[model samples]
Target: MTRRTVRIAMNGVTGRMGYRQHLVRSILAIREQGGLDLGDGEVVWPEPVLVGRRAHALEELAERHGLTEWSTDLDAVLADDSVEIYFDAQVTSARVEAIKKAIAAGKHVYTEKPTATDVEGALDLARLARDAGIKHGVVQDKIFLPGLRKLKRLIDGGFFGEILSVRGEFGYWVFEGDWQAAQRPSWNYRAEDGGGIVVDMFPHWEYVLHELFGQVTSVTAHVRTHVPQRWDEQGKPYEATADDAAYGIFELAGGAVAQINSSWTVRVNRDELVEFQVDGTHGSAVAGLRNCRVQHRSSTPKPVWNPDLPVTESFRDQWQEIPDNQEFDNGFKAQWELFLRHVVQGAPYTWDLLAGARGVQLAELGLKSSAEGRRFDIPELTL
Candidate 1:
């Protein structure tokens, strides 16, 4: 058997998403399972060199995971001849410069989105990767989720004949951090730190809509900061300048409309923290993070409006849960394995830097729409 080892420089892995999803759940999990099999007696193994600003934290993480490589020197790691890939999960504000430097150093790049704060910067990164002739990709992890996968399957099978509309509800109440500690990082509520629901979440919505229903043609939105005051990690109080909620209506290429409501200050009243309901002429389906329930035209219940009645019928019981037919792995890990295969072998992977740039474009337009209190058209980006 032939074994191929790819050296990956993982920067900013000290952060929450970086540490849990990328480091422990993905790369380390792959390593623990004896690497990935690539058929015909070939295997691909990953060697991760954890990179972060804190040496002690990196040391501790590496030791806890039984990993040998960890460093705080990003420049040195980027310049190393043996390093095959450079990955960034740092704050969005710090990603562009680091990615540019990695491209200049002749390393393949992959990152978490929104690729940049603006569309131009995101396109520039794509152009840089294209000019350098290095493989690149961005994480669009939601598509690989089990519930969404089932939704995709139903769509593929024409279960939703002539899809009419889609509604997405995402977010949960993050504590004000006075008596209870906030679940999310404080940086998520600070504009200076690249924190805002529109930029952070609209990107996911863009891809989900385009990949499933159609390309979004225009958007109308209203964004606002619900809880202006919040406590930080050090028990310090600060003013939140970034938006906490975004209510938007998007028109799709196929003439379908999608409405998305995202908020960090809202309470959950649904089956999951995130859910999307798609309705069509033939059927309707609601997908959560891990579960999807559907009701067809034949099975959909009919109800009469009566203000005086108690309305005792169970509305939620009409839809039936979709059965799991296959084993599913962590969404982040699924994307990572595909990226590793793209690097090792000539695999068909299309989620490139350009696609990532599209996400940024959607976010930029969403902000414009919110600010103007009007609809903004989404134009195709060319690089």
Candidate 2:
């Protein structure tokens, strides 16, 4: 068997998502598994070169993981001819310039979203990547989640016959950084720092809605800053300039409507932090991060509502659980494997920079809809 080593420059390893999910769970996990087996007696091995702003943190992380390559100088790393791919998990404000440099360096690129802070910047990145003739992708991890995958399976098997509508609830309380330090970085609540619920999450909704149900045709949103003030990492107070919550109604192409409520101020009451309830003519399903329960038309219980009497039926008990027929891997790891195959073996990868741009477009339109207090039609995007 022949083994091919692909060198990837992974920037932003010092950050939260960068350190935990991408670096540890995804890339290193692949290496621990003895590389990805491509069948046909070929194995693709990944070599990650950690890049970040903090030299100390990078050094420490490299030492802990026994990874040799670590760099604070992005230019020097990009200059290396051996580095075939550049991955970015940097702050939203810094992603564009770095990716632009990577494209100029003629390296394949992968990044977290919003690929840019705005639609124009996102589209520019797409155009540049296309012109550079480099393979590129953005993280759309939600689609790979077990619950969503099973939901997709049901949809494919025509379980939800003539899909009607979808309702999604996603969020939990984020500490205000006073008595308890905020779970999220203080920058997430600041508009100047490319933070806000709309910017942070609407991209995810765009892809999830598009992939599972249909293309989003229109959006109407109510955006708010529920927590007006919050403390920073240093325990200092600052005005929260960004919207903390957003209630949105998205109209899909197939006449199906989706209402998703995203908030950082709300308390959790559902079985999962994020859940989607999809209703159709034949069956209905409630899918969370790891579990999915369904109630079909034939076996669905009929409940009678009366103000005079207390409820007797357990509504939750009416649904049946979907069994996991196969093992599931981390969503981030799954996508990384796919991107590796796409890079080395010329495999088909449809989620490109253009698709990421479309997501940015959705967030932009959503914010505009909230500001204008009217619904906006989602225009088709092009390279």
The prediction achieving the highest lDDT against the true structure is: 2
Tens-digit lDDT string for candidate 2 (205-285): 999999999999999999999999999999999999999999999999989999999999999999999999999999999
What's the residue-level lDDT of 234 in candidate 2?
98
Residues 281-349 of candidate 1 have per-residue lDDT tens digits of 999999988999999999988899999989798999889999989998999999999999888886988
> lDDT for each of the candidates?
0.93, 0.95
Best by TM-score: 2
Q: Model 2 lDDT vs. the true structure?
A: 0.95
Residue 29 error for model 1, in Å? 1.0
Report lDDT (Cα) of residue 372, candidate 2: 93
Candidate 1 residues lying further than 4 Å off, grouped into runs, are none
